[model samples]
Target: MQRDAARLLYGNAVAGIMISLLTSSFLVFAFSYPRVDPLKKMWWFGMFILLLFRFIDVIWWKIKLQNTEFDGKKSITHFVIGANITAIMWSIYLVYCTNQVNDVQLTTTIIAIAATAGGSATVLAAHKYTAMFYPCILLVPGSIGLLLSEEKSLHLLGILGLSFAFVMLLISRKSANFTVHTLFLKNENSVLIDSMEEKVKQRTQKIYELSNLDPLTRLYNRTAFLEQLKRVTTKSEKQFALLFIDLDGFKKINDSIGHKAGDDILRETANRLNQFTSNTQLVCRWGGDEFLVVFAETDEKRAVEKSNKLISLLSEPHTTENSILSVGATIGIALYPNHAKTEDRLIQLADMAMYYQKKQMRSAVCVFNEEMEELFAYDLHLKNGLTKAIENKELRLVFQPIISSQTLKVAAFEALLRWQLKGKDIPPDEFISIAEQYGLIHEIGAWVLNQACLEVKNWNTEQEVIVCVNVSVIQLQDDNFISIVESALSENLIPPELLHIEITESVFASDLVVITDQIKSLQAMGIQVSIDDFGTGYSSLSAMQDLAVNMVKIDRSFVNKIDSNGKAIISAVMHMSEALNFTVIAEGVETQEQSQALLNLGVHYFQGYHYSRPLEIKNIPAYLEENQNNT
Candidate 1:
């Protein structure tokens, strides 16, 4: 738009200059040829006017020069040459009209010679080779005719020279028009290229922003988080705290309210977290329902205080159509130079602390301490041990009898994983938590499934005993977990219905869209899924209704004190299971009284030391035989 306006203004200025020059030239020509024939005078005046119009073209050329944006030295040279050509034509027309040359008279000859010489000089200076060459040719012959004689042949030769000069001028004017058009095209192309370059720069910036930002919440993602973490860690004079926060019970909200509402809740939660933290703090979305906050130059106390404030802010009720959802957060903090020297280790320590905090019933923040470091070191050692366990054949599966209270007979065996490091045995709780922390549970879970299926394949009993294996939340997160289970069953020639996977409530405490799909996939393959450690860890009745689960294993926390606080809890869980048509398994029955109490509450499936402790694979055969003989 601006370019067009410039061109118009330049064209108008050139037209005005041409009009002024043409008017002045005609007045000179009329005054000088007052006694000449009227027709001849008019013809001369008309030619003068045409020459003035060509001079006015100088204004148009000037306007073009003003509008044309030149990029380099070459364009400036071309513009100067075009301007000099217009100036030469104007000079020649002015001299000719003022002199009023008549073909029959020799008095105007000198003026003609001077005008041609001047025009030739201008053309040579402007580097218009074609215009200069023809003018020089006409000038030599006309000068020869003036010097030779006042004869009729000289007049004829002079006429011939003028006619040839006029034809050359017409050709030069045409060439000038072509040059103007070429310059216009070149300028248009340059403008287009500039516009494209600007657009490319904007797109590049947008791509860079998208790469670092989370699409949903518009916060920095894990990639950007690590970059900032490195910057903070490299500065030796600065101290900071990294807080690893995980949303508590976010899975239940997603399962009950739907994913759309869950996304809204996540966005709102991010905004609230940002609001609670100061501008100096950096908050990033650390994948899924996890967030990382970097508090600069802060100690554990201030970090925990800020984390608690964020938690409190998030705990406010978010009103939705399905329900008024309230959420809590567990934060783990690791201080710089105190926790670890590297950014990766510090983040790991913070995550470990956060997991430990979430395990506590009432704690919202856990600071990295010596004990946590020891735990992480131990876990690191155990992870290395676990990786080699399969190669060394150090892992063994033992079956604990699940006794039916009504029949007083073993109905199924829950497969328990045990690992022996050298001569020492590792407890399932210790290594299992480590496995979950290191995301190695999926591989370990697959190994357990294969071992259990292999064992069941060799059993010679006619009675079908279900083999239950516990699965961690991390195990179910794998997309191929169900396929792995099916492959194991097929390889061992065991029926899918004979294998049951027991997942704790914590497994369901994640995005149920994934968990539900996994459960349905397993159930579709004819495998039973049960929620172990029920009545604990964010369990909701709606989850049981929506998930494809067959049983609920009541946690021992309620079973241990059934005579007092446990009775009401046991009754509620049993009743809820019964109402939902789910089989209830009472766990941690250590005494005969506890077993009898569970029986009175109509609990059937029993698994604890009351029957047998988690036995080694060697002792399992004898235990089963002994129990069978007694029955």
Candidate 2:
């Protein structure tokens, strides 16, 4: 505020000088009397010198002192002092003129002094002290000179002069107050605008960071990676390798442990990748458990070596506070200019190779090849066609019977899904994995459940029989999975007990508590829940006991070697089942020898090609009748 006042005072100094010169000239012209001539000359000299000094002060301040370093206090002091001196000079002239001149001349002098004093009120308003005193000094002496005269008219003019001075004083005070208030408000508004601008800049930077960075891992997101890749491709002369790394069985681990642990694992994965790679190389979380890396100026050998190292580093057990979790990585490498020219093509080829490696040879790395292109195309075709499979009636269910060891009679039919496309059979292993990867498992699984329920409901067997429908861990994890099951049962008019849900042991690798609750919910609906391929999964007999499952099917892998070293595992499973009060069914029972061995070991149920290959629903009646005759 002081700085502003000082600036205003100096800025209007020229105008004050001009007005003073004009007023002084008029006074000199009017008061050309012989006795006062010398006094007039003296006043003119004083006014000339004062005007020159004020002019010099304005030039000096404008050229040398008007800056950030300008001293507002010192500047204001000089202005106030100079202005008061000017006002005093005018007052002395007014007094001398009032005494020496006639009444008419005296009145003219009073009018000139009063006008100058009133004008100075606005000019000196920048400073309170200057505004109040400059006008008073100019007017008081002139009014006193008139009142001290012997004439009555001069005395009345003196009273009017004092009244004018008082009015000028009030105007100057008000002007000064208004100026200060306006300057204060201007300063405050300036500060607020500056503050708002700074905040907006910071917020914009933060938003940019968020848009480019992954929130969980603090790594560059997919959009940032693509932009960087495009820059590298356009600018760099050297070849770089893009590695697409996908964590294997991550979904299972994520499901088995809680998502919190899953998030921890992902963070740790990112940290490890960042530590392993140099600053020249870019590492980013591509999405989910997948991460991408750009190895600058790298070749096949180096890419393989680095990828294997990354795999080893990541495969180390991730020991959390509650559980020790481990996941593997399948990496695929595509070299710029070597594999493809465009950025999108490079990324797509890299992703395709990664999926090929993950699907073909897990925990290994593969480079882009022509074969992968064909396979990728085939996968694309399958992905597009799988949804339409049901509508076209290309998908069918074949049942493999689970036989009772005691009566050698059919116990249950494990419904197996088959996709026959264009007269060629696409294996369940291939199409099923494709469906799960493409997020079509939920739809397909629901259809299979409904179909299985309908099939079992149409059966006219004398012996109590049920149909087992295999469900994926992904499907089971769905919140709507239980409702889907209920709808299937209700729509088909099949009792829940006749439609057993056969979940793979891999389901245990997910949120067990939640899966357990879901299983209990199924059992509450009077539906039996069984663990399919039991020993092959990351679960034990103790887990089964806690699960309270109705049945446990020995995995085909264990049952395949039943006549050999597999007996001890089966015997242990049998003993555990007896103690835990759950039925054990040995799968992949190929020959009579395997069935007899399983029977001797107290296995009560069997399912495999040795009894009957999985048959279409039309062949099921004949097979059951043949099995009944044999029994």
Candidate 3:
């Protein structure tokens, strides 16, 4: 920057010197024409010597300016000295040339002073003092020479010249000031343009970062992860693997506690994932409750080992403001060039493996395979069809009678869901698991409760027959599940005692406060609570103690055995049931021996194929009528 300024100064000064010298030479010759005075000659000669010396000094300075221009202090010092010398020399020339004060001589001196002073406006105006002094020096001496006039006309001309010199000085000051103002604005405008350019670059970079990052977890978003997958897959030699991680039971946690808890879980999960992942660039937030990771130049064995480590770490509890939350993860792995050549296909296979593993482990890590992929395709079809199954009348209720062992009569009927798609019956295990896996249980379970209540209302037996409908852990976690239950009872004009809700022990495996509160709410509405599939889940007796349960239904696994051990387990369960003052219903009494074994253990109620297979809603009327007369 300094170099450029110095260059401009050098060029302008040289040009001004040459122009001033040429114009003044013509004026000097014309004024000194005919015979010159001796005193005037000597004065002119002395002034010429000074002027010549100053001009040569400026020429030397200009030549050296090329080398010393960038030294800011030296360049400014040289310019100032050269400018001051020129001012002094011009003042001397004016004084000496106008000593006689002849009309022609006075005119010539005035013309020379004007021309010389005007040149400084362009060259030295940017330096305020230099421009101001140039005109002052030229005019001050000339006006003084005129002031010493003896003639009246000469005295008047002297006064006029003095006034004119004063006016010209004012003009020079303004020109210098205007030049300073122009320099200031040019500098400011250049700075402003540079600042705007920098700001634009910063904003553009920030926008790019936001587009590719997930706001909550601070991980890569779906779009960026896909781009990464494409980049990795394009390499033919280097192998990489894609991992899809899904947080299991996250929806239940979100619905039960709140979304804030879910968010905490997600952030903590991302942190944990980042710790296990050596490469930060490989982790991504694959939308809600799922993440995508890449292992560049990693083999399938190492991928599986890392996935297991991830699972173990994820299973550790995360403490939030309200609760200690812990959830499992399901990871699906697919290798590059091994699973598929294309990026989309690799991601698809990994995603399929993730869902497949989640279904089998109900949450764990597994690698992609042709079998798992094919099963996932079928499961995908089932999941998509399961949502619409209830609406399409593809699903219906089938009542399995639970009969009293001593009376040999129907005590209550458990409503089981049956799915028949396109004249082909889809097993409960297939469709129900699909529903639970994808959080459709809330929708499906509510429908079951509503349909059962309405169907039982149609029976109108007046015998206070109970209609038991199974509730899922997901359904129990739903905030609106209790409302749906109450609505079903009230809307159907059935007393809550005539309806029973059966929840498996898995529901107790969730938040105890939330689960117990829901069960208490159900019991408060006069609805009977039963822990179904007992002995098959974690515990049988202790959860019943927490719950306001009216009955405990033994899981079919325990009853179908009929071994001494099964009887012993049933005996302990019966004793516990009596102590708790709740009825015990033995499920899966498919043979006389299983029923007899249950009865000998002091169990009264039984349900299985031996008594009656699950009857469809339409066929229940005929069975109820036949049994109604007999009972």
Clashes of 2: 4
Q: Which scores better on TM-score, 1 or 3?
A: 3
Q: Candidate 3's residue-wise lDDT over 1-631, tens digit each?
A: 4344444556686576666556555555555544555544565455556456656755775676567624755665667676677677667666765654477767767766776776666677666777777777777776687677555565665676677667767776888678667767776787898899889888987787798889999888888877877776775558888898888879778876899999999999989888888555478998999898888788999988888888899989999966888898889999988898887888888998887876667667788999987787788899889879888988889899989888887889999998888898988988888898888888888889999999998885646678899998778877889999988888988898888888887876777778889888888888888888888757645666877588888888878666946777788888888888888999888898887878888887999999899998788778877777877
Please give, for residues 408-501, the per-residue lDDT of candidate 2 as tens digits. 8898999999998888899888788889998999999999999999888787788768899999988988899999999999999988888888
Candidate 2 segments whose C-alpha is farther than 4 A from its true place: 10-123, 138-335, 353-370
RMSD values for the candidates in order, in angstroms, are 8.8, 6.6, 6.7
What's each prediction's TM-score? 0.62, 0.72, 0.74
Model 2 / residue 336 / CA error / Å:
3.5
- lDDT by residue (tens digit), candidate 1, 1-631: 3333334323433443454345444444544545644644555465556555545544545655554662334433443344444444434443343334464343344344445444433233223353445354535445445435455545555555566566656655555445456556777898898999989989987897798889888788888878877887786657788889898878677766778878888898888877877545778888888888888888878888877887888889888766788878888999988878788998898998987777664338899888977876787889889888888999889888899998777788999898899989999888888778667787888999999999877766657778999888778878888889988999999999999999889865676778898998998999988998887767887877888488889998998889898899888888887778888899898999999989999996899988888766667667667777888
Cα lDDT computed for each candidate against the true fold: 0.73, 0.87, 0.78
lDDT of 1 at 438: 69
Worst 10-residue lDDT window for candidate 1 reads 119-128
Show model 3 residue runs off by greater than 4 Å: 1-118, 134-168, 187-211, 227-238, 268-283, 309-328, 387-392, 438-443, 458-462, 490-492, 511-514, 538-546, 560-581, 591-597, 616-631
